[model samples]
Target: MQNYIFEIQLKVRDYECDIQGIVNNAVYQNYLEHARHEYLHSKNISFKQLTADGIVLMVSRIEMDFKRSLTSGDTFAVKLRIERQGAKLIFFEDIFNVSDGALYLKAKVDVIAKINDKLSRGEIFDTLNL
Candidate 1:
């Protein structure tokens, strides 16, 4: 299967920041989650469907490096790429940037797949069909 990449832009909201107006570290997870959801949506597949099929795409690990802080009203673009995928595992990478394309973060996520709702040891590549 061919590799897939997706991107989206989101504006930092005041409520997502701390007292100093800098976006909270936890908020970066939210941005990543949003980008992930959006990328899946583009594939015409949803987590609900996967669950119904007795499959679970669980995050096994996440690594994020932050280079800059984002404040309220700052618009940032997130680029997501499917680095690797299989029948029981998937790997992805992302870059978060500003309007001028100034990158602020780089993240990698590892996902493990389940069968009959149970985690397995092998890789799962079913997601590539779409």
Candidate 2:
């Protein structure tokens, strides 16, 4: 079975859909980002607090594949796993239809942490050991 460190359930909203009756591609990015934030919160990490401490985590790159379309009212789950590679933290995220388990999208996000104004490995990630 595929392992996921965290998962969040969400429903497609009417406003998120395009004229084609499917979720707009950009909306999927929001869903993925929300899931990542929630996952960090679950681990007792606060994005706001990090920023306040001068530790900023920014997405350096994102690669996504759209497998299926999600329509308004469709419930789905956003799942993710994290790994550390060199100085970058990679988040592997996937979205699936909650009812049928159909994959809607898969994405890989590379994140880098900056301290003060320099790009360095934030100490916070060391605590997570991801």
Candidate 3:
């Protein structure tokens, strides 16, 4: 298990599943994204304010490993930790089944900060103490 700084629990919805009766590949991205946004909110950072300040957080890369399938009505938690890696913020995120503690997915997301449409060194993140 990784050292996680934040976690958010979510339940799988029926519509999120495909004909295979498991969550579609694309739906997992939404779960990860929502957890990130919630983490920012917990730190008192507003995405709207960031945009007003000309600071844009963009996804440079994302790697997801599907270890197990999430079926409808399944409960899970998205756990994540962030670290500074030069000009980017690397998020190590994982999903696990809440009921059985089974690992469902592992993801690494690379986020780059842009100020005034130019790539930044992510100093803003440091000041935020995130």
lDDT of each candidate versus the true structure: 0.74, 0.91, 0.95
Q: Provide the lDDT at 32 for model 2.
A: 94
**Model 3 lDDT tens row, 19-126:** 999999999999999999999999999988999999999899999999999999999999999989998899999999999999999999999999999989889789
Evaluate model 3: give its TM-score. 0.97
State every prediction's TM-score relative to the real structure.
0.84, 0.95, 0.97
Clash total of candidate 1: 8
Q: After superposing candidate 1, which stretches have Cα over 4 Å from the reference?
A: 1-4, 85-91, 121-123
> How many clashing pairs per prediction, in order?
8, 0, 0
Clashing pairs in 3: none
44-126, model 1: which lDDT tens digit per residue? 87878878988677887888998889889998888876655543344354545566667788788877778797676544554
Residue 78 deviation, candidate 3, in Å? 0.2
lDDT for position 124 in model 2? 55
Pick by TM-score: 2 or 3, better one: 3
RMSD of 3: 0.8
Q: Of the candidates shown, which would achieve the greatest TM-score relative to the real structure?
A: 3
Best-to-worst lDDT order: 3, 2, 1
